[model samples]
Target: MDMKKMAGDKAAEYVKDGMVVGLGTGSTAYHMVNAIGERVKNGLKIQAIPTSKATEAQARELGIPLLTIDEVDHVDLDIDGVDEIDPQFNAIKGGGGALYREKVVATLAKEVIWIMDESKLVDHIGAFHLPVEIAQYGSKQAMARMEECGWKPVLRVRDGKTFVTDNGNYIADLHLGAGFDIEDVREKLGTIVGVLEHGLFLNMCKRMIVGTSSEGVRVIENPSK
Candidate 1:
């Protein structure tokens, strides 16, 4: 079986009839979206709250009903993808630049699930540079501030232009090096002006469906969930 598909299908099994779901972004989540689309066609009634414009478009194309954050009381389940996940199940998401919205939807959901291949699981999260969403207005100042904090932030650019997120915010990919204290960085980033949200998702996921082409799929549970 395809690893991404295996992981995604594993997560789709958790979606019940008529559940209000939080749809996520990225490649692994893309597989889940397609799987959910198939379920929708077979008479599954689900309202999806998409975390990014790209995700919203995919879900819309798949005929999944979408709802704004204000439209629903709360999300029943959220299936997202992570950039990196640690032993404690703490994860770093926002690789698709949807950290702000993803975090919002995940928090509102009763159960949050992340789908990924085996490579995403890590001993620690710092290997992949973390994403920090920020306003474009004072991004230079923000980057300078991060540099002062020793994070070595870099602007995420696209086609010679600064990459822009669905929410019209800019992204700063922080290179914090190995053995860095993620919690301290999270706290410090929160205190910085112009910082909207970072990719460091601490204790948010209830379950992770990790897959590999050789091993099929397996589920890992977070104690908090």
Candidate 2:
């Protein structure tokens, strides 16, 4: 089976009837939504909270039922994609700028599962420039602060215009050194006035399903038990 599709399909199996689910963004997540749509068509009843406006639009078109956060106390599961994952299951996410909602859903859900192709697994989380969504008003100040933390911060732009998030905020790409202290940096960024949320997801995922060309599918549960 194709790695991307297999990752998505396997994650879809975690969804059950009458559950409030969190729908994630990106290509791998798009495949998950497609699989869920098939189950929905066959009467797998559930409400979905989409992580982005783009995903909401896609879910609507596919006829997957959607609900607001206010309408649900807790989500049964959230399946998302990560840019990279380490041995400890720490992740770098939000390449699509939906970190705010993704984090909200992941924290609010009972279980969070990340689906990714084998190529995304890394020894450390810094290989991909972490994306941080920030408020437009204090971005300049925030950028300076980020640089003080040893990250080369740059405004993210796509097709000549800034890549605004679904929440209408700007994104900054941060380059950090390998073996950098992620927990320390995450706490530091959390105190920053302008940041909405950074792409570094720590201690959130309960399980990760990684798909590979040769291995097919690999499931990893958190080892901190």
Candidate 3:
């Protein structure tokens, strides 16, 4: 049933005309961006801010009008994908190395929606290694600090080279293991000098769209909404 596409397309339905939208990065977000592009072709009007260079290119190719973050006071909505989301709605993101920009966009949006397949939903979040973006200049020291705290930090690599994000930072995937304290870890990571942003998305999402092969698409509103 292509659950990723299902969830992504469903999230796109929330977009309306004359609004400013924050377009997210990742595989699931690809579908949402595509769906929105189709709408734009049919005369839907909205200004979009892409979370990464990859997304910006896609949005440009799709004829989606683009805006820089500095041009917008606030985004009406932001839809992105999560690597892992727990029952408490805490999520692990940045699997695509766009965590820093994604976090910034999400923070500027009035509403945020996360789209993912049912497999991403878990009883807890730590199973998926938390991604922390750090400045390249002192990345090694940052990783060393994380390792000292037992996070088991591993630098992300792609094509035999270190994976660099759109913000030109390095990503360290932290293996927190099971039953770890989310708040404590987040606090500790923030204390690191070179740490720019981490993948822990807490208390931000207003809704989540999950796609399932059996039941089709499910939209869950945040309890705090």
Each prediction's number of clashing residue pairs: 0, 0, 0
Worst 10 residues of 3 by lDDT: 174-183
Candidate with maximal TM-score: 3
TM-score of each: 0.97, 0.96, 0.98
lDDT at 23, model 2? 98
Q: Write the per-residue lDDT of candidate 3 for residues 63-174, one digit (tens) a residue.
A: 9999999998899999999999987788999999999999999999999999999999998788888999999998889999998999899999999999988888899999
Overall local distance difference test of candidate 3: 0.94
State the lDDT of candidate 2 residue by residue for 136-205, as single tens digits: 9988999899888878998999999988888889999988765678988889998888998889888688
Alpha-carbon runs more than 4 Å astray in model 1: none
- Give candidate 3's error at residue 214 in angstroms: 0.6
Leading candidate by lDDT = 3
- Model 1: per-residue Cα lDDT over 63-129, one tens digit each: 9999999898799999999999888888888878899999999889999998999999889888888
Q: After aligning candidate 2 to the native by TM-score, how far in Å is the CA of 59 from where it should be?
A: 0.7
For every candidate, C-alpha RMSD to the true structure in Å: 1.0, 1.2, 0.8
Model 1 C-alpha lDDT versus the unseen true structure: 0.90
lDDT of 1 at 152: 82
Q: Which stretches of candidate 3 lie above 4 Å from their native place?
A: none
